[model samples]
Target: MPDFADLRERMIRRQIELRGIADPRILEAFRAVPREAFVSASYAEAAYEDRPLPIEAGQTISQPYIVALMIEAAEIGRGDRVLEVGAGSGYAAAVMSRMADTVIGIERQHNLVQVARERLDRLDFSNVIIIEGDGTRGCPEEAPFDAILAAASGSHVPKPLVDQLAPGGRLVMPIGNPNWVQHLVKVTKAEDGRLQQSDLGEVRFVPLIGEEGWRDG
Candidate 1:
C-alpha cells in the first residue's frame, strides 16, 4: 500500500503550500483529509496528485490547488458555518469541515450525493452534511452562511446565493462559460448588505445546473 499520509503531506507542501495557499488552518486541513478515500477505487493511486480526476456521472473532483485557492479566497474562520455547492466526491467538504464549525454540501445528482455522504461519514467527517438538491438555489433553511463556495461554474454568481449570505459573509465561485474560460470570483457582503466583487483568477469548472444557473440538458 502507498504511504498515503506521506503523499498527502508532500502534496500539501509541494502542490498546495508552495503554490501560495498561505492559511495555516487550510494547510492543516489539506493534510488531514484522506483524498484517496473520496476517489474511485481505480483512481486511488492518483488521489494525491495535483490534478483533478474523474469521479462518477461525468463529474470531476476539483484539483487540490483550486480547492485550496477557493477556500483561501473565502477566508473561512473556525467558528463559521459554510455552505458548499456541487459537493462531488465530498473531498472539498471534508477539508472545509476542518476549517469551519459546520459545513453543508449540496449536489444535484443523487448518485454523487450518495457517494459524497457515504465517503464523508466513513471518514468520520461528521461536521459536514450532504444534501441532494439544486446548488444554485443555495440552502435557504440554513441561510446566512458565514462562507459559501461553489464547485461548478455559470455565467454569473447566482442571485439566490448572494441573498443567502450573512451581512458580512463571503461567497466564492467560478463564473463564466464552462466550455471555455471562467474567472474565479469572490463576493463579500458588507454590513450594509452591499456586495463587493473581486476576480481572483481564471479557472475551469463543470457547468452549474439549476434554475438560477445553467439549464439542465
Candidate 2:
C-alpha cells in the first residue's frame, strides 16, 4: 500500500500549487478526498500525478488540475446542489460531495455507473447519487441544480442542461470536437433565465455520449 499522506502532499504541490489553482476551498476538497480510492489498482500509484488516468468503460478521471479548475469555476458553495455529467469512476462526484449539500452524477455507461456507486458507497459519501443515463440531457427530475459540470467534451453546450440550471446557477463544460481542441466554458443563468457565457481556457476531454451529445457509432 502507498503512503496516502505523502501522496496528498505531492498532489497539493504539483497539481494545485504548480498549476496556479489558488482556491482554498478547492485545495481543501482535494486534500480531503482520497483520490487513490477512486482509481484502479493499477493506476493508484499515479493518482497523485497531474495526469488523467484511464478507468473502466473507456472513460477517464480528469487530471487533478482540471478537476480543481472546473470546480472552482462553478463556484460551488456549502448547501449548493451540484449536477455532474460523466460520473466516470466517481472521483469528481466524491469531491463535490464533500463541498456541496447534494450531488447528482449521470453517466452513460452502465458499468462505470455501477463502479462509481460502489466506490462512493465504500467511502460513505451519501451525498452523491449516481445515475445511469445520457448525461447530455441532464437530470430533469433533479432540476434547478445550483451548479452543473460536464466531465466530457461536447461540440456545443447542451440546451437541456442549461434549462435545468436554477437561477444564478453555473454550468461548466468543455466544448469542442474530439478530433480538435476544446474550450472550457462557464455558463451562468440569470434570475430572468437569460444565460451568460464565458470561455475559461482550452481543454481536451473524452467525447460525451448521449442524446444531446455525440453518437458513438
Candidate 3:
C-alpha cells in the first residue's frame, strides 16, 4: 500500500492544487483528513488515487478534485455553518468540518448514515453531524446555513435548499438529468433575498433521489 500521507500530498499537488483549488484552509483540510478511513478496507490503498470509489450503498465518494472544487466555490470560512446533501461515506463532510464551524451531512440511506456517523465519530470530528433524511428538503431545523453543497445531481436547485440559505450565502450543486451530461452550478443568495447563479463546469453525478429531486430515480 502507498503511504497515504505521501499520496495525499501528491493528490493535493496534482489533483487539487494544479486544478486551481487555491484556498489554503481547504487544501490543508483535504490533506489532513484520512480519506481512506471513509472507504471500505478493500479500496483503502486506492483511496487517494484521484478517482471516485464505490462505498457501501449504491453511492460513491466524490473524486478529490470535485470535492475541492465545490468547497472552494462555497467560499467556506471558519465560522460558517455548512450543509452537505448526500453525505455518503462522510469524507466531504469531514473535510468541510475542518474549515467550517459546523457541518451537517444529510443522507437518505440508513446504512450510509450509520457508516458515515461512525467514521466521523472515530475521526474525532465533533463539529460534523450525519443525519438520515430526505436530502432534497434540506435541514429546515438548521436552516439559514452559510453554505450548502449537494453531492448528487438534480434537474435544478431544490427550492428547499435555496430557501434555507443565509443572506449572502452560497449553494453549490450539480444540475442536470440523471442520465445526461450535468454541469456544476454555484447559486448565491443576495442579502436582499435574490438568487444569482454561475456555471462552474460540466460534471457527472449520481441522481439526487428524494422529494424535490428526481422523481423517477
Q: If scored against the real structure, what TM-score would every candidate get?
A: 0.98, 0.97, 0.98
lDDT of each: 0.93, 0.91, 0.93
Q: Residue 140 of candidate 2: its Cα lDDT?
A: 95
Which sequence of candidate numbers ranks them by lDDT, best first?
3, 1, 2
* Residue lDDT tens for model 2, 105-138: 9988899999999999988999999998999999
Better of 2 and 3 by TM-score: 3
lDDT of 1 at 165: 94
- Residue 129 error, candidate 3, Å: 0.8
Residue-level lDDT of model 3, residues 31-55, one tens digit each, is 8799989999999999998799999
TM-score of model 1 (CA atoms): 0.98
**lDDT digits (tens) for residues 1-217 of candidate 1:** 8999999999999998998877899999988899999999999999999899999888899999999999999999989999999999999999999989999999999999999988988889999999999999999998889999999998888999999999999999999997998999999999999999999988999999998889898
Q: Between candidates 1 and 2, which one is better according to TM-score?
A: 1
